[model samples]
Target: MQYSPDSDPSYDLKIHAGFKVVRDYSFSFDKVEISFKDMVRFIFPSTGYLIFNLFFGDDFTLRFLNYDLSEDLPHHLYITGLLSRGMLITGQQGTGGGYAMKIHPVIGYHFLRIPMYQLTDRQVRLSHIFDREGRPLRQLEANASARTLNDPGVKGFFSKYLPDKSVYLRDPVYHAVNKIISKKGIIQVKKLATECCMSERTLHRQFLLKVGLSPQSYAKIWQLHFTMELLKNNPGAKLQGIAFKAGYYDVAHLARDFREKLFVPPSQFYRDVNPMMQSYLDFPDSLQ
Candidate 1:
């Protein structure tokens, strides 16, 4: 069934279905809970973030790159790394719920202590990553309820893993990432390299090592994200205007990017995809 953002009860029901913000860390992460029934969501590519998912109900399936890869996630905790392409998720009818933590990629890299490139477009069980330490996290997940999910107990559990403040301030890639975001991905790689005081080649290498995606790829993702935000905020705005604002040379360029990355033209995406599904694109205020 098609869901319309307005004048449709099913759309409202699906969009509102048990979605809640458990907590907002402002600086580093967000804790949220989601429950849904027979939902299919298309998750667009991200600028860069690691998503920690804790599932508590029926299984859901994730398909990437037009089903070239598919995985079933049962009731358990999993973490997904930065995705350079869109993903499709399907949850069958009947209620299912989960908790998610969206973390900054730099912090994710420090926590995982591995080259970020290895995790690009991948999801692994939390237990697999943490080994013995994962037991306590599982226990906490088992004990959590909607009301108590955001308690200090859980917050404290994760606090120990928070990277040092200096780590963020000292990282050149982090600064470059922020500059890319601040400009809404309008800056070119050469200009970004110059501003960051590094050669284009060095910047590209560092960005891949640190964020799992090259600077140009990351910028494109952010550019798409920026376009999505504009579409969401101004549904009545013209595509041509939106394209230029999002750094595309013309509407055709914007449409080409959307077709290549999202598998749909911008017009179809704006018309068919519910705004609620794109809510994840809203970065935390701290990031802005």
Candidate 2:
């Protein structure tokens, strides 16, 4: 059966995401993507499914972006599928995506069919907690190890946490195109694919497979997300400042993107946040 939650306010962005204390790897229906000029961040609930994250093209070094996963990889290190179990993401900004990983939505199920099976987590494999009745628990750490995305051995037990079509896919180009789109903020698909050394048709096929949005469409979403962060943190931020910071050549360009995606002027978003010191990543945007 096809599932559509577009009408469900619970999954909408009106409230944004508040803090979620880990129980036992919580399953989420909300797949989120946020942008900040050259920086793009994606947080998706692996929600019980058989999917993998495919990153391709280019590599970069990271600074404060490093995290304490079950293990650590260089910012430019390219690995596919599960990054690490128990991923302690701490803002990493590097380049390189020619890697992909097939992650089973199940707690610790590693596919026997992957290309890099030998390079998975060493000390701790993936596993899940369960209720007495056999339901998988959320964020349980009874027998936990340093978590990494690519758990080597254990398989997930529950089957109910799968994600929807829009949230799961198998393509390596989404990140490829995203690389350029994030840097440029917006571009035509054909032009983007051309720059990536592929036909527009191939580009579209791979992009839609992973990102679930057309090239232009994703760019709009990305720009809006980045703009939101900028405007949120800098309410008194000038249009020109936001524009230049967000990779636009002029304030007019910023205004155009704002009107197009948000249906409101950039200035309108300023009055929303109050001043406060905060852990930008750990704190929910609302605490501002």
Candidate 3:
């Protein structure tokens, strides 16, 4: 199906990665996008489009083929879980103004409960990629998708639970801190406290009450998350170069961190873990 941005009143005002991807039918079968981290996604409700999940986000989808989003008007969203991988296999569309956030699955789930914070990111297995259920979970393939906004199967899932104004009580703290992490990879706790205009103890408290993981842990996660991204883009980059770019002091430090998070060293093989190069080949302009 074709997708254009939603112009209605209820949709999330933010856009994400606005770009056009042209598919050459004779030269190629399909163009695919794959990402491991969280990313902002949008679809125009006026146009019927199925937003397919490419990686770690769509663990609980029920249906895989012939899904519809035209009826999903009020723009429902949720803080999605950490997807092992992510992919989008479908027709062309336009979207903009969003990026991948650093929040972990545990912390992200809490954000879903907030009303004003519609985790617009969704997980859906594409029919073309995986036949039946999209990906396997707990030994078997998972068979669920975020129910359509107006779908009878799960109507009002977001409305019935999330708050009306803002779902997060610590919105200011989380927003400011996360913004810093986005730009700086790793940040000191004391510096984070000052940046948010809150005390050190208060920052820790807010993190605990709202998000289960501590701030330091979250930063480390984002650090490695960024590392994975850097490795993906600069495939020829050596360990030290990748380390410095991703905010590490040396190659050993980078290797240790990679092992701690992904259970493998940087030299082992990241491409085998995920098809990073092929995904980039799909969007040459963006990579350039």
Candidate 4:
């Protein structure tokens, strides 16, 4: 599951009692959904990409981007910027069929050309930034509903939007980010700055510019991510063992970190929902 810059993610399909998560890497698409459940809340961490959601049904009302409970965004395509952390709560889910595309971190900046740090933990209409004309995801969503679009069509859609790689795309900061992700956020921030031959302040600036989070913040989130992965894959593993393996000093240390980041203990966090979907969608093994 090692991912090079060009590597597409591996896929996995998970079937819950009522909802199914199609973890397809076919079009750089992370997950597809056709929900039959009433409500599901998704807790997602930073994935360094702007997420495109081509929502097809009107039954589900998702409250994110600080939308009020009365707001209903139906039959529209939504775009979420690089999130530091966020929650998606679906109200009255019946048929929320959709396609999700993970826009490359660099390409997001290239297209928007704005400070990504400002976009952290927010959502906007994709049409608002790129506009409705020549909207690829909207077209794909239509075709998908009609059973006219295949995997190749999805691939072609993204190929059209791939950004030209500038020096920043291949810079040391980019490499350092990948290295930290590869090690499951276990690597030291000081070591990463040294390897990139930049001062710690410079490293932080680059990360905020490119990935919308400081390296320290991303690393902490990734540690929680790794812990979740371990829990999902090895349900029988002891809490103490999982914590230590995920780079926490002990179970208490892990608990405190989880409380600060997730606002819940690990056990309570995993009790209500399937962690697998979030894990696969957010921190796929290829990127890890």
Query: Highest TM-score: which candidate?
Result: 1
TM-score of each: 0.76, 0.37, 0.47, 0.70
For residue 205, give model 3's deviation from the true position in Å.
2.0
For candidate 2, write residues 172-220 as lDDT tens digits. Answer: 3534543643554545667678766888788665544443334555455
Higher-lDDT candidate among 1 and 3?
1
lDDT of each: 0.62, 0.36, 0.38, 0.58
Better of 2 and 4 by lDDT: 4
Per-residue lDDT over 1-288 for candidate 1, one digit per residue giving the tens place of the 0 to 100 score: 123122212321232222333233343233333333334444444545677755544443333434325453545556677777654433322344445556666667776666778778777766567667667666655564312335554455455555665776688888898788788778889988998899999999988888889988888877888897888788888998999889888999999888778767777676656443444555353221
For model 3, the stretches where C-alpha displacement exceeds 4 angstroms are 1-150, 165-170, 275-288
* Candidate 4 runs further than 4 Å off: 1-26, 30-49, 58-60, 65-75, 85-88, 92-94, 131-157, 165-169, 275-288
True-structure RMSD, every candidate: 4.9, 17.4, 15.3, 8.7
lDDT of 1: 0.62
Candidate 2 ranges beyond 4 A from true positions: 1-170, 177-197, 273-288
